[model samples]
Target: MAAFGQRKAQRLARADASRKGGLDERAAPVVQLLNGRARFCTTSSCSGRLVLAQGSAADANSWEVQKKNCTWLMVTHETCTKDDVMTALEKATGDVVLKFEPFVLHVLCQELQDAQLLAVRSTHCLEVPLSHKGKLMVSEEYIEFLIHVANRKMEENTRRIDRFYKCLEVALKTAISANNSPSQETENRSVYIHRRKRKTIQEQDVHTSLKDHNEELEPEDDTESNLAIFAEIMI
Candidate 1:
C-alpha cells in the first residue's frame, strides 16, 4: 500500500541516520518478521537497552527533555550491575537516572480492524504493554502500536536502578520468548479486516477510532518527583 511504503521509507531513512548502528541486533528477527508481512510494518523500534544519565533536574518536567539534555554516564545493549551504576553515580551532579527500557516498537497496521486485532493479540499474547498513539502525522496514516516494557522508576536512583535492571532482564526475556514461535509469527501476519471493506472511514470516524485504540491500550501514567543522590553501573 502507498501509505505503508511511504512511512516505511521514512523509518528506514531515520534508522540509516542513527550513529548507534540504527537498529539494535536483538530486535532484527522480530522486525523482519513483522515488516515482511503485507499487513504490518514497523515504524520504530529499540531492542531493549539501558541508559545511565545525569540531568539538570529529576522531575516529570525534566523527563520530557531527559534524553536531549542528559549526560550519558554509560549506555549498554546488555545488562549491567549495581557497581556499574554506583560508579556512574559518583560523577552525578544533578538528577541521575538509570533507565532500563525493554524491547519497544511502533508498528503500523494497514487497517483499523487489523490494528485492533494486532493490539488485542499483542497484549493478551505477546504480553508487552502496547500503547496506541493514533495518527501522529500524515505519515502515521495507519494505526500505530507503541510497545515497551513497564517503565520503572524510583527517587532513590541507586535503589531504583537496581530494581530497573532486574525488571529489564525479565522484560527482555518476555519479549524474546514471545517472538520465538512459528505459530505466533503466523498469527501475527494474519489479516483481520472483514465486513467493512466497503464502509468509508470518515475524518470524524478517524478520531473516534483513535480514541478506541487508546482505551484498548490503557497504560498507567507515572510522572513523579525529581531523583537525586545516585550511582550508575554500566555493563
Candidate 2:
C-alpha cells in the first residue's frame, strides 16, 4: 500500500511541473511582422514583446522578443508615413521604413540578394526566427543603405519639380504682358489713322472750292472786254 501511494504522489508532482513549464513558454516574447497583414512571430507556446529599430538600436526587453542585427526590407507604401511605421512597431517589433523609388526599387531585389552573401558570412549568433516579410532576399546592410538612397532620391525629385514650376510661372507672366501691351498699342494706332483720314477729306474739299472761284472770274473778265469794244465804236 505504501509503495502504490508513493508512485501516485510522484506522478502528481510531475504533472504539476509540466503545467509550470507551459506557463513559462507563454511568458516569452512575441514579435509581429507586417506584410499586408499582422502576423505573430512565435507559436502558441511563446508570448512576450521586443522592438527593433531599423538603422538604430533595439528597444527594451520589457517583453523579451529576439531581434536580428542584420535584416533588410524594401517597404513600399504611398500613404504610410514614418510615424505610421513607428506606431505599427510600438508593440515590440522591428520597424524598417523603406522609401520607394521606381528607379531604385527595380534593381533593389538583385542588390539585396548580393547583400545576403555578406550576412551569411557574419559570425554565427543564436538564430532568432525572423518573421519573413516577402520574397526579397535581403540583409541588414542592404536595408539600411537602400533606405538612405531612396530618401536622397526623393529629395532631388522635389527640387526638380520646384524648379520646373518656377520656370512655368515666369513664362506665363511674360506671355500675358506681351499680349496686353500689344492690344493697347493697336488701339492707339487705329485712333491716329482715323484722324489723318478725316484731315485728308477736308483738304480735298478746300481745293475744289478754289478751282470753282477761278473759273467764275475768267467769265466776268471776258464780258467787261466786250463792253469796252462797244464803247469805242460809239465814240
- TM-score to true structure, per model: 0.46, 0.25
Total clashing pairs in model 2? 4
Q: What are the per-residue Cα lDDT tens digits for candidate 2 across 31-110?
A: 11111111111222212112222423244232232234533332321223344433443432342333232211000112
lDDT of 2 at 13: 44
Model 1, position 32, has a per-residue lDDT of 73
* Number of the top lDDT candidate: 1
In TM-score terms, candidate 2 sits at 0.25
CA deviation > 4 Å runs, candidate 1: 13-15, 58-65, 120-235
Model 1, CA-based lDDT: 0.49
Candidate 2, clashing residue pairs? Answer: 28-47, 29-48, 30-48, 50-92
Q: Candidates' lDDT values, in order?
A: 0.49, 0.36
> What is the per-residue lDDT of model 1 for residues 1-235, given as tens digits with 9 covering 90 to 100?
7887787666655645443757776666666766766666777766655565566653524333246786776676665555554465556565544465555667887777446544421221122111112111212111112112212211232343344446544654565577697777766444212212212244347658878878443442333211111111110
Off by over 4 Å in 2: 1-133, 183-235
- How many backbone clashes can be found in candidate 1? 9
Best candidate, TM-score:
1
